[model samples]
Target: MNIVYSSSDSYAPIAGVSIMSLLHNNTDADEINIYMIDNNISDENKKRFENMVDKFGRNIVFIPRPDLNKMSGVDIEVGRWNISTFFRLFLCTILPDNLDRCIYLDCDTVVRHSLREFWETDLEDKIVAAVDDCRSDRYKTELNLPCDSTYTNNGVLLIDLKSWREMNVEKDFLDFIIAHNGNITYVDQGVLNGVLAKKNLVKVIHTKYDAMTVFFDFNFKDLMKVRRPEHHLSEEEYIEAVTDPYIIHYTSCFLSGTRPWNENNNHPFVGDYLKYKSMSPWKDFPQYPDVRKKSKKMMTSVCNAMPKRMMIAGISLVHSKLYPMVRSLKGKRRG
Candidate 1:
């Protein structure tokens, strides 16, 4: 199994917890090789990863961060998301040429099951396979994609590196980013979908492969009530994903915007994260302050004050109607 992740110094420990969970859960696999794209990670953290992977009898290779400045329009500011999020865009360029395929997992995810089947499955000539997430008709329209095209979460990707290199996807990614005038809402996410999904180059997969936090917090009915997605998984599949999720992606909650690693977060998977933390090389590591300031505290209190159902309804109304109307304005919707 080949796995890739990107992280900076501030997020390296959190990424370590996710890696520990992956190694701990996939012991049955014959071999697992991890490739971490370095982003100013401290030497201490690097050693932690090396020692951890050694103890697990796995391989860990640290790839030096590539220069994004070399790419046109890469200097554009991306909201909240860091430059590391764009690292995967150069995978075919930066990784070993011999590697034909790899699974790219975001640093925020925890693996709960083996990925043998998912890794070995064929892509059927597609460049990548990922779970369909963040569905919205406006997303396609914003990118000028065809009506039937699908949008997927770039968080967990099974990439055909060989095909990507053949098609020069790295160049295509740069062109898309530049064409958008260097302004992308979700940074690398918008670029991936804009270039790949528009051409029908992505294979949509089950949510079990990347079960986001939204799944844990809401059932299909309530999710529709809150998110108002244009497309989504069926009720049966949603339940299965939540009940036996293979990869738990601890995305921020809409109600409170909290994550499992935060102190006051109400994420149901906090226990899972804690268990993996205890098992990692950072087991003795102390928790850092969650770094909330007074303004954020006040907002959290305000959001918490609302009734759950009322908040869901309000969010539903905004997502299904008001938000779409707002996005319809030129330059408002992200590609």
Candidate 2:
């Protein structure tokens, strides 16, 4: 199994925990070739990675950053996102031509199960297979996509490199980046969904594959009320995802600076993340003090105090009203 991750020096520790979790859970694989797309990783961090993988009897290969001359003039809205986020867009140029398939995981994820099934999932002519994003239809309209089109989260992509190359996905992605430029909100993620949404080329996988923070934070009814068709997960599936998730993506909490590695993050999966961290080389790394704003902390506390059913009801009502206003605004913009 080939698994890829991209991170810079600052995010290396978090990436190390994610890698540890993957290696620990997927030991059944005959071979696990881990690849890291480097954006100037520090020598010390590299050693840490080497030690972590060495303990598990797996080797990690670091792919140096590729030239981004083509994207020089393209405007990128890199709000809070590392420039390394764009590395996946150029995997075809960075990885060996002979490499035909690979799984890409974000540094903020932890795997709880063997990836043998996910690694061998049939792409069936699709360039990528990924779980749908929780942002729902809002993201489609935000990217000027058709309302019914699927918009996926790029955090956990099963890529078919052969198909990506044959279909010129790299060039198409570059073209989209150049065309949209400053209008992009989620950087490479926006470009990916915008360009791929209309192509019928993305396979929407089950939510258990990438159970995000939102999945645990929100109830099933709340998710259904806001998410699009492609993002739907049955009640049974939702329960299974929370109880026995294949991959737990600390996306929202990571983005919001409330991750398990930080003090007072309070995310439900903090223990899961810490369990892997304690087993990694960076186990003794100091946790950053929780510096969240008082207002945000208060809000989180209030939300946590509410009953799950009440919270879902409140979010559903908001979505019911907000979706119409969003549609109206979009219609006027089109006009």
Evaluated at residue 19, the lDDT of candidate 1 is 95
lDDT (Cα, 0-100) at 16 in candidate 2:
92
The TM-score of candidate 1 is 0.93
lDDT of 1: 0.83
What's the number of clashes in each of the models? 0, 0
Query: Which pairs in model 1 have colliding backbones?
Result: none
Off by over 4 Å in 2: 67-72, 226-231, 253-257, 293-335
Candidate 1 residue-wise lDDT, 1-335, digit = tens: 99999999889989999999999989989999999999989999999999999999999999999887676645655667788898898998779999999999999999988998899878896889999875556666766777578888888999999999999988988998877767765678888998999888999888999998877777688887777666778888888888888898887655556687776677776788889999997878787655666776665566568887887777677766666556446455443
> After superposing candidate 1, which stretches have Cα over 4 Å from the reference?
293-300, 320-335
Write down the lDDT of every candidate, Cα atoms only. Answer: 0.83, 0.79
Write one digit per residue (lDDT tens) for candidate 2, span 1-335. 88899998978989998999999999899998889999999999999999889988998999898756445465555766877888887788888898899999999999999999999998786788998776656657766788777778889999988878888888888877766553455677887887777787888888888988877765677567534344455788889888888998987542234667788777777888899999998899988677767876776666667786675566555554465356547545644
